[model samples]
Target: MELFFKYLQYEKRYSPHTLTSYHTDLGQFSQYLEQVYQITEPAEADHTIIRSWILTLVQNNIKPRSINRKIACLRSYYRFLLSQQQISVNPMVRIKAPKAPKKLPAFVPEESFNTLLDSFEFEKSFEGQRDRLILEFLYGTGIRLAELIGIEENDIDMRAKTVRVLGKGNKERVVPINDSLLSCIEEYLQYKKSEFSDNNSEKLLVTNKARPLYPKFVYRVVKKYISLITTSDHNSPHVLRHSFATHLLNKGADLNAIKDLLGHSSLAATQVYTHNSIEQLKSVFEKAHPKA
Candidate 1:
């Protein structure tokens, strides 16, 4: 298991959060095996036992995506065992994962996004400037919450008006920034410099004390600010990302272009935004049409 984690960190270059998730999932599976069947080795596992474990997970009300992730972990572990000649066959070869339900991505309407931005008074105070820039950057770039928090000061290119994002698999992509967002970022940086003249932290976003931003902080910021402007129940960094993609799609942006902007590995991953757009269109049609 330690070797597998090393592989994920060094060779696969998965993000630390993802590596942690994989570790947790695999650890739970190992504990289950040990507690239920006294199985201490991957080689001793068989398909029947694997299937039973999955059944138990289902009975416990685990979501299909999570179950599929556990199955993936098992497959990787067993495949590694096979390569080492520790197992004669992979038991997961014939085990099928349950189909994941297609969930529609939630997004704030364009008016709501604008309302949230317009609500920022942009006082010279550090908190005001920082909050404005944080929300602007999230909407403008369509970056994931994790990616946004991981951004370093040097990652932003003022001249090029692009931010270099280190995405999943340690892949890097440059996302262009709008001129308004660029100006906001500039103002925020100036405020940061004035406030933290003695401190030299490199993170793009930081707390009042100049500590780096964490995931929960970002979430709360989004929730608080968005709740003030919009009545929608769904308001988070991811909803901002979804809104970004949906707005672009509504404006006739190329699907592949949107995919690159979102840093999705494949077009399929980015295509969910199209479904949201279609649903919006359908609503419009139903409201406007005079058909009986």
Candidate 2:
């Protein structure tokens, strides 16, 4: 088990959140085996045992999406064990993931976002500047929250107006930035420099005390400001990303271009935004078309 975790962390280069989820899912399954089947090692569990656990999860009212995630974790674990010859047979080969209903990602409207960014009065302090920059940076670049946290001052190339983002699986891509967003970065940099001259943290955004930005802090900042603008359930940094992609699609941007800009490995992942665009088109046709 420890070896498998090490493999995921080092060889697979899985993110911390993914590693934590895998650890938790495996631990839960291991406990279930020990209690029910008197099995100590997960590698000994057969397809039937795996199926039983999944059934138990469904009976416990676990959502299909979460159940599927756990199934994926176990599949990876068993595959690793099989590759290492720790297990003669892979249990996940026969296990199937239950279908989950697809839900569209929630996004903010362009007008609401513009109102938030343009009309919102951010203060003059460093924290205020940092908060505004956080919102603008996420919406402007459409990078993930983790990627934003991983940003270093050197990752941004002002000369080329691009930012190098380390996406999923440690893949790095350069995203272009407009002059307005670039000015926001520069202004925030000036404020950060003056506020934390002695600390000299390489990370682009920092706390009031010059510490690097964390996930919770960023979430709270996003939720606080986003709630004021619109009451969309999607109030996190990812919502801004959805808005960025949806707005671009609504404006007739190419799907492949949006996919590349979003750093998505597949076009299918980027096509979800088109659903929102299609809805917008339906709304326009219904309102403007003379035919009832």
Candidate 3:
């Protein structure tokens, strides 16, 4: 199991966040195997045992999307074992993942974002400046949380008005920045310099203690600020991302262009934002159409 984790870390070059998820999933399965079948190795478990574990998860009301993720982890692990010739055959070959409903990504409305970014005033304190930048950066670049946390001072090219982001699977893409976000970043940097005078961290976003931002910290920041702006049930960094994509699509931005900005591997992943635009069109038609 450790070997498989190392494989994912070094060779597969999976991000720390993704590696942690895989570890957690594999750990749970190993624990299940220990309690149920007394099998120490996940590799030793056959299809019946794996199927039974998945069945129990379903009975426990696990969502199909989450179950599919676990299934994907096992499939990858077994493929690794097969590559090492440690297993004679893949046990996941016969396993079928349940179909998950396709739901549109939740996003903040443009008016909410406009009021937050343009109308409402953020504090003049360093923390306020940083808070504004956090939301603006995510919405501006459409970068993932991990990518935002991993940002270094060197990643931004102020002259080019672009920031380089390392996406999932270690893929790198440069995203353009708007003047608003760029100004926020510049102000935040100046404040950060004064606040952390003794520190010289290269990471773009940091904590009050000058530590690089973590997932939980960023989540709390997003929740706090987003709560002030909108009554939307969703209050995470990804909502800003979805809003970025959705707003762009609504404004008639090209799909391929949005795909490149979002660093998606395929057009299908980017197409989800179009659903929001279609919803917007439906609402407009209901209001403006003369034919009832």
RMSD values for the candidates in order, in angstroms, are 1.9, 1.2, 1.2
Q: Which of candidates 2 and 3 is the stronger one according to lDDT?
A: 3
Clashing residue pairs in candidate 1 are none
Comparing candidate 1 with candidate 2, which one achieves the higher TM-score?
A: 2
- Distance from true location, Cα of 263 in model 2, Å: 0.7
lDDT for each residue of candidate 3 in 1-292, tens digit (9 for 90 to 100): 8899999988999888878888899999999999999999888999999999999999999999989999999999999999999999999998999899998899998898888889768898788898899989999889999999999999999999999989888999999999999999999999999999988899999988999999999899899888987787799999999999999999999999999999898999999988889989999999999983
Candidate 2: tens digits of C-alpha lDDT, residues 1-292: 8999999988999988799898999999999999999999988899999999999999999999999999999989988988999999888999989999999889998999899899988997788889989998899989999999989999999999999999888899999988878988999888888877787689998888888889999999999999998876679999999989999999999999999989999999998888889999999999999993
Q: Indicate which candidate wins on lDDT.
A: 3
**Model 3 residue 106 distance off true place after TM-score fit, in angstroms:** 0.2
lDDT of each: 0.88, 0.91, 0.92
Pairs clashing within candidate 3: none
TM-score of 2: 0.97
- On lDDT, the stronger of 1 and 3 is 3
Lowest lDDT sum, 10 consecutive residues, model 1, at: 115-124
* Clashes per model (N, Cα, C within 3 A): 0, 0, 0
